[model samples]
Target: MRQDELWGEDTTQRYDTPGTGMFAPDVVEPAVHRLAELADGGRALEFAIGTGRIAVPLARHGVPVTGIELSQPMIAQLRSKTDEATIPVVVGDMATASAPGPFHLVYLVFNTISNLLTQPEQVECFRNAARHLIPGGRFVIELHVPDLRKLPPGQHAVVFTSGPGYLGVDTYDPLHQHLTSHHFHYTEDGQARLARSPHRYIWPAELDLMGQLAGFELESRHADWKGGEFTAESGSHVSVYRLGPVTAT
Candidate 1:
């Protein structure tokens, strides 16, 4: 499915899980705190600011926020929580859409960058973030490390989560660095539903190279929002890259 269709009405309806999963105070607060610190009281821009999950709270924390999102349905959901005057959003692709900026901070969280599904697009995403940031501003991303190590010889799929009501699996294309995540949800009424999304998994070093190509320097990388150590064993990371000062010839 196309990116917009994948996050269409049905997905948008089920996207917000209040006080649970990603919405848990423990999960949300730390991220908000870190982002607020990065914003440093200046304006912030969120790439793919779905449903105001972090933007709303970050704005409430006193940083003015603007957003870029492709899904109109998702934007509709976000509007229910806050008005445009409070948090303006430009509707279009994060890799190419321009929002009002020179923002102090630009962020893309929860592996959203992988949605670009191709190397060129992902590179453009980095450039887009750079375009919106002021000199020395930061661009933050939270993404998962590919689980290729978990796959034994000849295995192409891995089960990342298995629980009473849900099952999540990822199938990989090692040659292309592509992945398709399948999520199965079982209702108490014995109904089952499946949702799948495609992604282009990226390595940390590769991501750093993208940052460099976009004129950014790696500032910090942590296992989580709380500044935990990022080791080889870490499954995901929150990486911060800072744009360098612009110079004239």
Candidate 2:
């Protein structure tokens, strides 16, 4: 795979297709709705706020936003939104950037934490968010819980009988605990365009331990804000943390 062809840069163009709102209205709306209430109506920061999907809407909800994003094309895609140009952005890696100002909330949505491939980077991301958070502020993350044990070898793609022609290619290496997924969207012309994303999957409990390592306390957690308990079968994990006072060196 060519380096440029993979999912490293310009995530906005990749994830922000026009009329994409209707693609997963049920899942996206609930997630956004939950985030809005937790925002605290104060200075809020979004790590990897791609194309302003949730950020734009949260801004519309009358909250100020500071975005830390790595890709310029992703930042450009945010401005491409209706009335989203005013949202301030800092173009840098969220794991190491001085995100500026003491924020009441710093959030990473859509499992964006996995974008950082290594465990060290993910830990630093937590520390960075803590560095920018105000006293008693919160750090929020909505991440996917990987079901690796369910996948078996010799499986590349399977067409579901329910027929949107769902094909799932599971690419995971047990040695590294990395998941590289290849999603193929079939066109009417019998061609397919692949959206291959590589992610480092981590369990929810393990991430909580990571937060502890970064001076954050697990404040609250839910399976979903629609009122569900987190279980092994849960598809997603929505977590919240309260940052401890800045540690002295």
TM-scores across all candidates? 0.97, 0.85
lDDT at 79, model 2: 78
On a 0 to 100 scale, what is the lDDT of residue 134 in model 1? 86
Give Cα distance to truth, residue 140, candidate 2, Å.
Answer: 0.6
lDDT of 2 by residue, 88-152 (tens): 88878889977668888899977889877889989999999889988788899988888765656
Candidate 1: pairs in clash: none
**Model 1: runs farther than 4 Å from truth?**
245-249
Clashes of 2: 0
Count of backbone clashes for each model? 0, 0
Candidate 1 — worst ten consecutive residues by lDDT sum? 240-249
